[model samples]
Target: MTNPTVAELIARSNRLGADPANTNYAGGNTSAKGTETDPVTGEPVELLWVKGSGGDLGTLKPEGLAALRLDRLRALVDVYPGVEREDEMVAAFDYCLHGKGGAAPSIDTAMHGLVDAAHVDHLHPDSGIAIATAADGEELTGKIFGDKVVWVPWRRPGFQLGLDIAAIKRAHPAAIGCILGGHGITAWGDTSDEAEQNSLWIITTAQAYIDEHGTAAPFGAVRPGFEVLPEAERHAKAAALAATIRGLASTDKPMVGHYTDSAAVLEFLASEKAPALAELGTSCPDHFLRTKVKPMLLDLPADASVEASIARLIQLHEQYRADYAAYYQRHADDASPAMRGADPLIVLVPGVGMFSYGANKQTARVAGEFYVNAINVMRGAEALSSYRPIPESEKFRIEYWALEEAKLQRIPKAKTHQGRIAFVTGAASGIGKATAARLAAEGACVVIADLDLEKAQAAAAELGNTDVAIGVAANVADADGVQAAIDATLLAFGGIDLVVNNAGLSLSKPLLETTEKDWDLQHDVMAKGSFLVSRAAAKPLIEQGMGGDIIYISSKNSVFAGPNNIAYSATKADQAHQVRLLAVELGAHGVRVNGINPDGVVRGSGIFAGGWGAQRAATYGIKEEDLGQFYANRTILGREVVPSNVADAVYVLTGPELSRTTGLHVPVDSGVAAAFLR
Candidate 1:
């Protein structure tokens, strides 16, 4: 039987975690105390169910909660060593577990258990943290809450900080909660509703106080020529610069990127004090862990040309790397985890927006969101008083904490296509959609580019929303449409790492029956379409300096002399040579160009469904339904080929298995003897 209290706890946590104003993603925890029958003793025992380590309150569930014996948890204080050894207490939490398996306890478990309340919430709301990180936080707390809330000075979170809060609550019976200086807030109550209300009260009161007493322009006036650019120009500039920034960020390790042009980000970038405040960096641990201590600021005027701005960025990046290394060296001790990396996760550019990087898309997006929270905190802090953060040494201690290293090590190994971005043309259905799905499953971000916007978006949604895939409308035969698609890809995921030229139309016609229009239509959508898409995608691919893959979806018909397939076969033959041409030209840049020759992909193929299958069947004296079997019987392997077979070939060619093998054609026609490469 499940405990009602834990269920209510999860419900309360979800409510608190759902709003960005309440807290950033995965930035807070909630808990409830309940009674459960112990399996060994067969008796009712008090248990504390708290949001465990590395979980977001908004998505908390039963398994996400760590249940421990309240008696044992509270008893930890009796044997507590000093704050110097408080980390040992975290390890001790494992021993106090009441059941066989539960979520591993977080550093915050002590704060929830030690407090003598039935319910509690620890959140990093931007409004509350604004007061918390202000230089005069203690004074502000008194002025705003008037004794209803107290203030606790900066202390690294552990068993010690837990005891400090519990002591304050005992001493101030009238207080609902306390503001954690240079951190956030904590509230407690006899019931879940009361706890949530108290938390909301603190957040609302702090925000109202700031609004009443704050400066109209906390970041100072926007500098001349630094205002946000027009929407079209801003995105175009961002698209052009994303690859360069991503390349710099990936100096230490490859990173998936996310771009944000939110109002807050633009306003901050245009402010007079933006550079100085960004230099001081974020205060809250959660903020810095994601945004780094500070961002890599692109110090250039808003109107600077893209080439000049990129040159300046390159220079600034070299210095940023050096400064980061020095920061690590200044505080690192023998026990410290080897400097994780010198690369900055967040980059700020005037007139444009922000670029954030991480091992994956969600991580990168969340990092940007956290910086937005930090921006809000900075706005309020500077308005109330001067923005002040904890000492640099303290930040260093937290950044290099042994506990954080342990958590990182527990992350599972990355998938083969992890951190890769693949652009698949004509991905609304059939081979293109299947290829996109396969790449996404292996951890690549995919762009579903096709002439049909609605179907492309639907396919993208099916692959997994914007984080894993996006849809863009592109007529691959049109240069402008192709360029727009490439630009959209860069803005969505930083740069292109893989290109799949699979958009084609098929038409079966005999020597006399084939018209001039038939020849041009097939060539325009296939031969010229592949060329336009590849040429446009190649600019960013080369700009990123990350060497990428370009795979042309040609056909076995390119080699086999089949009757009444003149136009389609000729275009395929054109595409087949493009593979060899580009492979040689791009080899020096590490861009591998390859081709896939697949025959008889009748089932689920848009090209076949659109009259080509019927035409071919008529020529071969078989029904459209029997065309697949008829082609299969003609193949040496006697097997029917489907969209998935072509998709699998695409995966292998782009994967590490073929990392060194390029300028080659892999057949996916179940062994076509006549179509075999010479």
Candidate 2:
């Protein structure tokens, strides 16, 4: 018979409720066929269109499929777990996906590309209830389909799953597709019809089996309990638990375990089956990597001692660590030191569901999902037979395999600007402009703050459609103006990442000859201005949770104290100290505060003006033309200090490359200050 039509198959899939419902806000996606441009050649190629972020599969239209370039996607899959190189991959894919040759790639593009079928279809089918719910799924699977199907245990989808599929293709070249135990299924074919048929067959077969044997009644129930504690007592208990978890993990932010009233959970705890339930972990082995083999079940009277409850939790956690260590040791290779270390990614609370932990939020979420799904599956599976995951040996190999570990290694832990943001003050001019430009070039959303409103706007315009730069005007000494600048920055980009306090005024004056008005004028813009801007920027930086960097632009005069420069010297000294105080106060928030002291910067309007440069040259007894050489020769490297040099110092503190060193005074004076000391 002729292959079923794509429309007909999709309609049938919808009728069977296999496709995600468009009206169901959280339902999944669908796709179509089209073409996109090639990034390298700017040529159009055939593409299998996919839904955009918000499109629902049930009501999906032809427009929903994004027309992604299959060839480009295939290339990306070959480089599995290549998130670190996502920028390059995305750029290429966008060119191929949209025919734009420079658009952004979709987040799911990688997964869609690697499926290796003409019309690949995927969804979290409710038939997940069948495979996941079956406690004796392995035997049940055998009884159901025998050798016609392959059973691959559950692994977190995305890079790891993709990589595993690639490996399976290499090993069992004829295997059509595999069941992702406790998760979902993948069906593919040369045509959309074939793919949908495969999917329908899988779902219907599973449904038939579940309909025949699945239990309808709740397996267990939890009894009610009461807690009569004062508000203060409850607050104290939560705070103490939060603190304890944080301390144990050496992290400031830990998952705060929640108190739940699930009857299923309470009944499970009160039942004689609790110990047996603890012995068998989540339904599938994949969950072992998440919630561990067991949860910490708390069993105590409502009025039981608080200390006793806490002590039990602590003891369970310690036991988890010990068990995890033992598992690692047991499976670890004797010859390899690196192979002998691993830890539990999750903790199970007996009466509570599960508490997943990770170095960051995304990882924690993944762990939590795995645990919840696994528990539900195990409970269902218990009805058929005892719930048993893959052998520990197999789990150890899957978890510790250098290839699988390599997959984890491939995922970028953090994007380039993971923790920091940058603001470049006085960004319209020579040093300031270059500094702002450099910060943007290094992944910072550089906010160009300057008194020269037009110049700042011009500088931003020059950056040319770069998402990493914004221009704002502010007289740094005006508290409201500074605050407004910061507010605008937050509105534009969520939060402030870094502050390049480069906006300042300079004046040359003799010590006794300087008037109070002149001293105040110089200090107001240089020292006081930097202080005000930093103060305004601090609140949002702290709220960002990733500490921040504040770089004060002090001059070399602060260190190489010179004749007739009393006002400049005093102000620079105060600004440098301000950075020190900022470092101390904001360190807890993870902010790194520092100062860059530059001298003899060539090509600038403020201090390097015609008369000022000539006068400074005369003071050193050098000709105006020879000033550049004079300053250049003063440094050990014989390099002239420029705006780019100062910008480099700012970049170092804000970039992902530096993680530890902070609260420093970096001299970008071409060694001029050191020369004076010598």
- Please give the CA lDDT of all the candidate structures: 0.93, 0.59
The best candidate by TM-score is 1
Q: What is candidate 1's TM-score against the reference?
A: 0.99
lDDT (Cα) of model 1: 0.93
lDDT of 1 at 22: 91
User: Could you give candidate 2's per-residue lDDT for residues 420-488 as a string of tens digits?
Assistant: 346778788878888877866654566788887777778887875424466889898788888767766
Candidate 1 per-residue lDDT, tens place, 27-64, comes to 98899998988888899999999998999988888999
Worst 10 residues of 2 by lDDT: 18-27
